[model samples]
Target: MSDSINIVLRFALYLDLMLLFGLAAFGLYSLRGQERVSGAQLPFAPLLATTAVLGGLLSLAAMVCMTWAMSGVSDWIELWPHIEMMVWETDVGLSWTLRMVALLLAGFAVTLNKRWPTASLGLVLLGGAVALATLAWAGHGAMDEGARRSWHFITDFLHLWAAGGWVGALAAFALLLRQSEPRLAVLARTLTGFETAGAVIVVVISVTGVINYLFIVGPSITGLLDSTYGQLLALKLTLFAVMLVFAALNRFHLSPLLENARQTGEHRVAVNALRRSMVLEFSVAVVILGFVAWLGTLSPEME
Candidate 1:
């Protein structure tokens, strides 16, 4: 059914948004904290800078997909909805254009790698705010009316910020394990900090996601189990649960191994494991984005 397909699609979009922002957040945090400890040998500076630029490009693509997915056109009408006109028009439909510009600047700032505290911090704040705002139009708050909408918006924003910061730090974590690299000690410290930050972000996301479902999707338990929106939501939750599994492995099992290896002056295995885990996380993130995209298209039934 079209509805079924839409549900699947929604989950993908959600995953994509989370992954994209997650990568950016990690990049920003790493750029801020990791590089100082990493010394000049490790390429944390340029890596984070490139990730920021990639995040900008990804943000643009996501905005376009969001626009196309939301026109409410079913069947073939969905295929051709003034795509040509949008291309030619000077006035873009979404406010995300400004976000794209800001992200581009953020990318530039990072690449320049000077006075990063001010430039990078400003970019993170602005970009984070804009990223959160985009969720409103992406339907985080739009389904509800009045104060409920406001509540939904705030919760979703917090959820996003938390997730972004948490996941974004993963990039920094990844930078630590580059063969027999000497930055192992520095990487260990950075990873420890990220572990703490990630915990806080997870708690925020769980709390906010629950509030969103309660206020916007209705308070009944049955609503979460029986509806199309509920099913999609459940699926997102499931994927997140799986992501947490990998996160746990990395945090508890692998991270300790990495630290031990660093202390022992044996680094290759830990680094490789870390790299593999990160890649898996990234792949899962993509699937989650597709689901989110589909979620934006579905209506949470009120009954």
Candidate 2:
């Protein structure tokens, strides 16, 4: 039944990633685009907001599943004294910390919108910093070591932040599109800011991802492709590639459509195209996250 257990574990991890990234995309879109549009449509704010709330909730569940799987694999399986039990004791403090940071950012996104740049910047920096720092002692980063370990930690931290930013911005963008507002200029500017931030985050995540492969999977390419651990990593990478494709389509094709709408006054077409692209992108991100959670629990081929 080890195979069955592994399958179940993979399934749970997949769900967790999907919920985390999917919610992030929804949140990002709402934060970035919601205020730029009219209110006649479903109002992208509520849908994306719901996505964040649900995504956060699901992410918490994913974490629990991760803890369970990790404990089982490590043979720390004393049912009564498992780390899973301590999640509410002292270990969960970090989880709460990150959640608080996320909530604070969400609040700022709601209240600030565009009126108070200073306040928004301060909150973003503070929340992002705290969220990133906490990861050093939290789940995956806690296990890294040496010079390469720090590299892995920083990259993972940056990846989380970037993922949050991209997903949150996506949520905001969705709202803007839903409003079908005739103001294409506002949407274009917001999308530009999002693209810039996303580009940086993606670079950081990619660099860190490579470092992680080197440190965790080792130097041998054969180790990664020939082992169970490597196979799982490959699967996660595949999902990530798919998410990247969707993100590219949204960034290149749909974003330009928004720009064109502003110039040509075809607001409806731009909004429809952007909205559809974002939704697809968000869905793919969620699936990728699930793979991430599962991968975290298994032993690397090098190990």
Candidate 3:
């Protein structure tokens, strides 16, 4: 039961932080001129702020749950000392502190979004990155030492950011598609921007994924089938591949159809197709995140 709670918290935290950061980053890069300001069609600012707030709350809950799991103490009064010890004397605690601080600032940034769009977006982006990066301290990377630990963390961080970028952009894309009378021009532009960004994200995720796998599971293919961690990793990769197929359809078929439809001033077909594809892709990403959360709770070396 405790393990289930911990996994749920971790999954929630991961998804929230990714949306918070990825949405902000997408707004900064994809939206242009008036599109980014107060009168913009998309409600990205409010959505980002909401995600940030949720991420903050999830971070707090995750901290509590982690302390409970580590100390094996459930009573609030009895667990106080153990929680205090973890907070003051551990790397996870320090990382949690950093994430909380960043989340607070990010929440504040949302309030200023209307008054100062550029500055608020910048703050949210930076804060989100910090909050997301801190997750590395509590994951498999933290098990290493010295230089290997540093490298492991670097890969983990990059992998996280890349995954966040992809997942977040999919969310934004879905929301945009839901707009009452979708703007073909705006959709085309956003899709084009994502195409470029997605390329980088895919490359980064692929490279860091291989690096992380080597670090955690070494070169043994048999280990993948023998352990829970490896099995979950394989499942993640399979889902990712399915996502990739959907992405290719979006880029090659649906995106081009959108462009042609825009030219012909008839885009409902393309729009609906893209929307359905995004829904599937987003669903797959969520499943992958679940696998990741579960994998984090198991030890690769134990196999």
Off by over 4 Å in 3: 301-303
For TM-score, candidate 2 versus 3, the one ahead is 3
Top of the candidates by TM-score? 3
lDDT rank, highest first?
A: 3, 1, 2
Kindly indicate the candidate among 1 and 3 with the higher lDDT.
3
Top lDDT prediction, candidate number = 3
- lDDT by residue for model 3 over 198-261, one digit each (tens)? 9999999999999998888787787567877777888889999999999999989999999999
The per-prediction tally of clashing pairs is: 26, 25, 0
TM-score list, all predictions: 0.72, 0.65, 0.97
Query: Model 2, 104: alpha-carbon shift in Å?
Result: 7.3
- Residue 161 lDDT (model 1): 70
Global fold similarity of model 3 (TM-score): 0.97
Estimate the Cα RMSD of every predicted model relative to the unseen true structure: 5.3, 6.1, 1.3
Model 2, 238-273: lDDT tens digits are 867876786788788878877876777766776887
Summarize candidate 1's per-residue lDDT along 112-171 as a digit string, tens digits.
444454355455446545644565555657656787767787887787677656545554
The C-alpha stretches of model 1 lying farther than 4 A from their native spots are: 1-94, 115-118, 178-182, 223-226
